[model samples]
Target: MESSSELADIKMVLAALMQGMNDTKGKAQVVEPKQEKPSAESEGVEGEEDVDIVQHETNAEEDKGDEGGLATYMKMHQDFYASLHYTRVQEMCKQKNIQYFRKDMGAWELARLDLQEYKDMLKGGKP
Candidate 1:
């Protein structure tokens, strides 16, 4: 008898929940965002399909022959220089007049110093 009463209470609670859900259905408010007007430039002149215009600027020095090639060559062979022995790297730095303190730097440091000095030279900095 008590179990039947508990089952009836459970059914009543479920029915109330279902009725609440049904009442709220199809009554939800949806908000749409307002769109902004396009500017005259963005709309473009009549008869032209809307297209984005971009401007590209090239570096003057990058077009020069030997100087441009130097940057490219160093970039291409960075790994080769880094792989050389400390003594060889130091010798190359000396030959190229790349300023680096060999007493405190290892092979990798020496290689990077050489590359950086070359880059600076290309930029018209100290040789």
Candidate 2:
């Protein structure tokens, strides 16, 4: 008798929860985030990283004959490679046939590596 009464109580709670859940799912409000103008200092660093890469490559075309400049450009990219995502690092490991447990290490540590081969390995290679 007690078990049956408990079951009935459970069913009542479950029914209420099921109905309440529908309200939450369909009535959710989403607001667009306001974009902020970045400070000049930040504008030069993180904000310009992607743009720098594009600009750097184009600039390299103008200096194609400067082998030292080309090497320096590649080295500069590797120097800041720690800004890369962990999944990217994992992808590089996959491309280079390197075995690693992604969960066992961090993206920061992998990105901090000074190895240019690891950083650019996935640019046009097989995983």
Candidate 3:
């Protein structure tokens, strides 16, 4: 009977996790590239290599995000944050005066807060 109750609790936890994962999966909007009409100067051009347009598009998006703010920077560098140890993240957060849950928060979350704090300091804010 206790085993069955434990299984039910696990199921509830799994359901909540799934919901959170789905919520975090935001749809990225794609910007359409403007197509230019072929000019007579390029009509006879041949043997040129085709560019990876998608790569260029994403680079431009990253550049735009850099100018936007910390949220975008955090998203772009999640892997870097995740790689840090929890203790280091907590220390950095403390040094920067970034509010974080000492026991509940993981390394990546603390690291993100630390990064935002650093960026805010760079921008002359007191975060």
Identify the runs in model 3 with alpha carbons over 4 angstroms from their true place.
1-44, 47-69, 76-78, 85-104, 125-127
Candidate ordering by lDDT (highest first): 3, 1, 2
lDDT scores in order: 0.67, 0.59, 0.68
- Those runs of model 1 whose alpha carbons end farther than 4 Å from true positions after fitting are 1-35, 44-54, 65-70, 80-127
List TM-score per model, in order.
Answer: 0.25, 0.23, 0.31
> Top model by TM-score, which number?
3
Tens digits of lDDT, candidate 3, 36-120: 9989877767567666766733577767767755766676556565577767667766776666575235445654765777677
- List clashing residue pairs in candidate 1: none
- Candidate 1 vs candidate 2: which has greater TM-score? 1
Q: Candidate 3 has what TM-score? A: 0.31
| Worst lDDT 10-window in candidate 3 | 102-111
Please give the distance, in angstroms, between residue 68's alpha carbon in candidate 3 and its true position after superposition.
Answer: 3.2
